[model samples]
Target: MFQDNLTDLLENVQNGALSITDAVSRLKTLPFEDLGYAKVDHHRSIRNGFPEVIYCEGKTTDQIRGIFLVLMRSENNILATRASSENFAGVRQIAPNAVYYQQARCIVVNPVKKNQDANHYIAVVTAGTSDIPVAEEAAVTAETFGNHVERIYDVGVAGLHRLLAQLDRLRKADVVIVVAGMEGALASVVGGLVEHPVLAVPTSVGYGASLHGIAALLTMLNSCASGISVVNIDNGFGAAYSASLIIKEIMNGCQE
Candidate 1:
């Protein structure tokens, strides 16, 4: 929808249906819009492939709805991370079709399946069942961006056999995101096996000595695997964002 608007604006200028001055007035909201409480980045999709995502953790229900309404006008896929049931309630008031992922704790509005590179896909792996919330966040984010995702859960290193069993499936992904909590060794193991880029998400899902996932974060950062990249603790969204960019590049290069 964001791209559609930009194209429409250019077409209007080219066909002389709208004057340059009039177009400028319409585009004055390009970079951002100030809503007193927040500066909504309306131009985010122009800069990046996806539009700005609402991080609903700290915002009020009214604020989330306000931003959701503004972005809805643009018609792009809308995603709000760390959202509660209350947040979804607020968003649903304006966007009746909005859906909430309970496990992922995310609210999605205008989710359009993007299968430009359906043959290619992302694999979202988790070390244990406890890490699924974070893993779900990554998977949903990728899907919201129109990217295909393969979820492989609870295949941590402790069992070894579980992960080994899914080796064939994991090998086929364009990019792999390994989400782990304790020690975070799963990322290294998967990184060693997969030839593609490996994104490690350290989750806050361990005992007291885990230091609230700091241990896992440090372990992932110091992995012996060559192509492993680590995101912040419980940052499935960040890992997914990077993986989406990788998938985009691969899809574009194939067309070229």
Candidate 2:
């Protein structure tokens, strides 16, 4: 349960509306739930603002389904990343309401309406069309985390004017996620321009010289721009997660 839900339950018990035994029974799964192959972390939403996300890369269909089943009992919004279409199809059998994102290769199950708090916005930019998959991954991941996301695609530095045109939107974002491959110079350029934090995601979308994104990764890591931060090659999820934290900090104005 979330803090508000737990507080309400406690108050109900104190007022004699609920028996202590019943309350204790309800909260028996507060910490976690054992599912043989996995232990679903039900208390994540209580500790963090968001619920736990499933990473479907290395999991079998049955394993994913079992873990998802336990998490669904908690009744929080669910997100699973790096899920294949087949995985989503299996999950959909269990969660009919789940939606699969083809471009991002992610799945989302929303039993409750999402709280679209757009007071804060995150901008996701891509250097070229080839980098769109990673860019979409970052954009969708950020949106799943409850942040309004704006996407600016195919604005590589080769055409500096295209990127310049969106300077106003870039400046307005609470945090910016720049996704690029090849030389991966877009992050440095964006970092130099925007006052907000810039998350650099290098994808494996380049020629042999690119060394499967290692060259771009090194370039981004050595960026002279002060505000640019780098994630692993093609790790859009990591960049999005970091951007979410920055946006949340700016929105809540809390430091910890």
Quote the RMSD, in angstroms, for model 1: 4.1
Residue pairs with backbone atoms closer than 3 Å in model 2 (clashes): none
Query: Could you tell me the lDDT of residue 181 within candidate 1?
Result: 98
Scanning candidate 2 in windows of ten residues, the lowest lDDT window is 111-120
Tens-digit per-residue lDDT, 111-167, candidate 1? 776654657999999999999999999999998888989999999998999999999
Question: Candidate 1, clashing residue pairs?
Answer: none
Question: Candidate 2's error at 144, in angstroms?
Answer: 1.3
lDDT of 2 by residue, 94-210 (tens): 999998889898888874445655657889999999999888888878888878899999999999999999999999988899999999999999999989889999999999999
lDDT of each: 0.91, 0.86
